[model samples]
Target: MKNFDIVTLTVNPSLDKSTSFRGLVPEQKIQCKNPRFDAGGGGINVSKAIARLGGESLCVFTSGGDTGKQLEALVQKEGIETHAIAVKNATRENLIALDLNTNSQYRFGFSGETLSEPEQQQILEAVSGLKTKYLVASGSLTQGMPPEFYQRIAAIAKASGIKFIADTSGEALQKTLETGVYLLKPNVGELAKLVGVEKIHADEADDAARTLIDKGQAEIVVVSLGPQGAVLVTKDITEFVPAPNVPKKSTVGAGDSMVGGMVWALSEGKPLQEVIRWGVACGSAATMNEGTQLFKADDARRLFEWLGRK
Candidate 1:
């Protein structure tokens, strides 16, 4: 296997198909445009975002059936190197449709195929055998899979001295924290859940993130505040950067783009402040595109430059 500075894992991947229609009338036969297909999931989107930034990472995912084959083809089209593990069940598909009249986007997602016990073990074996500086595990666990799956991977990464970064929510995210990670990217709501709070206001974002860091759950906690921007918290550093206003588009891959930007920056030896800025820049830039498309390199660069002056 070839070596890479960053490695991303997507246990439950999807083939995302997007289209637009004139209006959303009840039970009407709405005429829709041709659908756009993209290989989507947390880790895969991260790899694609890294590629958009002129960087490379090994994308490891599960592949099965015709949908899986098509997903692999789409990832190849993006020019990302991948290591796909075959499975018995087909990969899931998701739909995203835009209502032109209301400018609203509706997303429909299906449950992923459950992984067999043996298949689950294969995933662990693959992660244990990898050689990389960063191991990023993202997305939701499939049906019937243990919530501690990511935590197990975190343990493997720890034993191998690989920096683990996780982007997930709910029980899976909670379990992974038990094993600890190098970094965690959680939205405001998810962060609130982690710290046992009902909500985390903007003024309390830093302390909320610090609660996790203080418990040794993570070395760095980056709380994404959406339009308000993001906050990066560590034991010694707490920097809050406001988001730059931009035109609205689809937000399908914004969070993954942020993770991709931060990991790429960390790999390049950038400072923590600049790393958070790059993350916010890429995330904001991702919303400038339609459907499941990530940010353009030019837009990200422009946003990064603008953010530097703030």
Candidate 2:
């Protein structure tokens, strides 16, 4: 196996197919344009984002059947290194349809097939054998896979002193927090659920994140506030970076792009503040593109520079 500074694991990878249609009708057939395919799922997208920023990370994912094969080819086309473990079931694919009439994007997602106990063990063994500094585990666990799966990965990362960065939701997020992590990015609603709240307001975002940091759930907590921007909370500091205004298109992989930028910046020895800027910059830039294509390097650099002035 090749050496890498960062490694991303996506237990439920997908083949994302996107298309546009004139309008959505209740029971009538609608004419749709040709579909576009993209390799999706959290960790794969983060790898794609890092590659877009001229950084490299090894992408580890479970793949099976023809869809899985196609997903690997699409990811390779983006110049990302991959280590795909074969599974017993075919990989899942998601649909992104743009209704031109209302300009609203509708996303249909399906859960990936469950991984057997042996297969889950294989993933753990693979990560244990990896030589890396950062271990990024993102996306949802497949059906039948326990929520504590990420917590197990967290243990491995902690024992090896590898910085663990997690981007997930619900029980998975809660369980991972129990093991502690280097960083965690959760949206307002997701954060609220973790902290046992009905909801978290934008103004209260920092305080909410601080709660997690103070509890040792995470050393750094980044709460994404959608179009408003994001708040970076740590033991000593709480900073909010406003998101750059850009032409909105699709938000398919914006969060993944953010993680990619922040991780890449961190790998480059940038400060935490600058790292968060890169994250917001890349995430905002990703919204300027269609489907799951992510962002252009030039656009991200432009946004980063613009954000610095603000």
Candidate 3:
């Protein structure tokens, strides 16, 4: 088997199971066929996108009981190498139902069983010993974790000379930013939450983006504005990357795909501008698929050009 130099850590992971039916009726017991299951969570999705792009990465997270084993088998089947810490409770399972005739999808999510302190510590030790060049820590914070975990992880990454990219929401996002993250991917809601601003419209990107940078919280911020595209902010400059007009799929894994593409491009020494292009491309491409199946590099590149990449 080949080796990987990038590692993504997930605090909370799950198995995403989806079923499709011709019609989704209201208040009726409807059965669906063409059901599918996949490994999921923000970091796991990032790893998934990386694998599809012909890159390698190790997905690290907590799993336990039957669900954990199933998740491992599923991920390995998809060719993603993993390093996981087993816990007591069963891993979570998220479900999805798609109505093909209506071209609509519905999803239901569940949180994974929480990890104990020792389990959390063990994962931290594993993270401390990981030899990857890029440590992508993305997703929700486990319940019971200290608020400073992101900050500590950032310090560890700095000490180890690893590029740390964080994608989290709410208070976790704010806490992570306080750690001087190398890069952060925050949607408008997340950005708004961190800034204590409830509304983040297109006109608010400049001020919001600048405020995060000026606070010495994040070095680079990618403010995802959904269909309107995204805003990229550095200490001194901000760039806008518009989304491609593609037939919508399900809007799943778009952010994770963007992070995967960004980290991949940057790892190859691509300029930040080009990296942002690839990130935007991947995110846009992901919106072209349903459930968790994200964009591949080639398809995303084609969409990139159509989106007016210059």
Candidate 4:
């Protein structure tokens, strides 16, 4: 069996389709440009980002029906090794339509298809069988699955000596933290929720993250501040990196890209400061592209260089 240093799990993957049209008129057929398709979902996109950085990771996701087949084909075409767990339900598709006239993007998302008990077991088995150093479980849990789904994966990673990283929200995020993870990437709002606050200011982000670390919820807490860049906080250190200004087109897949960059950097044995820099660079670069196309390697490299000089 081929080995991978990083493994990403997207229990509920999506076949992302995007296009653009002018204006939003009721009861009118809208003429749209040619649609673009990309394999999406948090962990899948993270794997794509890692691959773009000339790194390799196994992307494990659920597959079903035609949409699942399409998703598998799309990721395979990207040259990423995948292990698709067959499910009885068809995979879901997400739509991103850009209004040319208003220059706005409308995202239409569907609830993930439910996973059966046996199928859920398959996902856990798949992860448990993998020999990897880093195990990333991202995205929302499918319908009919408990929020503790990620928490279980966290337990599996812990037992297997894998460094678990989780990027999710709400109850799912809350449950995963109980199991403890190595890294967590949460936006300011999500971090606030974790700490039982209504909201947290940028100044309080370091303390908020430190609280989680102190409680053993996560070893490292990375608070993403959107335009303000990100802050990396551990038990002993806290560092902030300002975001670089760029031509922003879309914010899709930016967080996954950031996680990818950080995980890849960590795998390469980069220090914490450089790791966060690469993450911010890749995430900012992702904003330079539209839909789920993610970030280009050249753009990320340039952004990373620019960040280093700053």
Candidates in order, TM-scores: namely: 0.99, 0.98, 0.92, 0.99
147-230 per-residue lDDT for model 3 (tens digits): 677777887888888878888776666777777777888888777878887788886886787887888877788888888888
Error of 1 at 91 (Å): 0.6
Instruction: Note the clash tally of each candidate.
Output: 0, 0, 0, 0
Candidate 2, run of 10 with poorest lDDT:
237-246
Model 3 has a clash total of 0
Q: What is the C-alpha lDDT of each candidate?
A: 0.94, 0.94, 0.81, 0.94
Tens digits of per-residue lDDT for model 2 on 99-198?
8888899999998898999999999999998889999998999998999999999999999989999999889889999999999999999999988999
True lDDT of residue 275, candidate 4: 94
Residue pairs clashing in model 1 are: none
Per residue, candidate 1 scores C-alpha lDDT tens digits across 1-310 of 6799999999999999999999888887999999999999999999998998889999999999999999999998989999999999999999999988888999999879999999999999999999999999989899899999999999999999999999988999999999999999998899989999999898898999898998999999999999999999999999888899999789999999999999999999999999999999999999999899889999999999999998
* Weakest 10 consecutive residues of candidate 1 by summed lDDT: 21-30
lDDT value, candidate 1, whole model: 0.94
| Candidate numbers, best lDDT first, in rank order | 1, 4, 2, 3
Could you give me the TM-score of model 2 versus the true structure? 0.98
- Stretches of candidate 4 exceeding 4 Å from the true structure: none
User: Which portions of model 2 miss their true places by more than 4 Å?
Assistant: none
Q: On a 0 to 1 TM-score scale, where does candidate 3 land against the true structure?
A: 0.92
Q: Clashing residue pairs, candidate 3?
A: none
lDDT of 2: 0.94
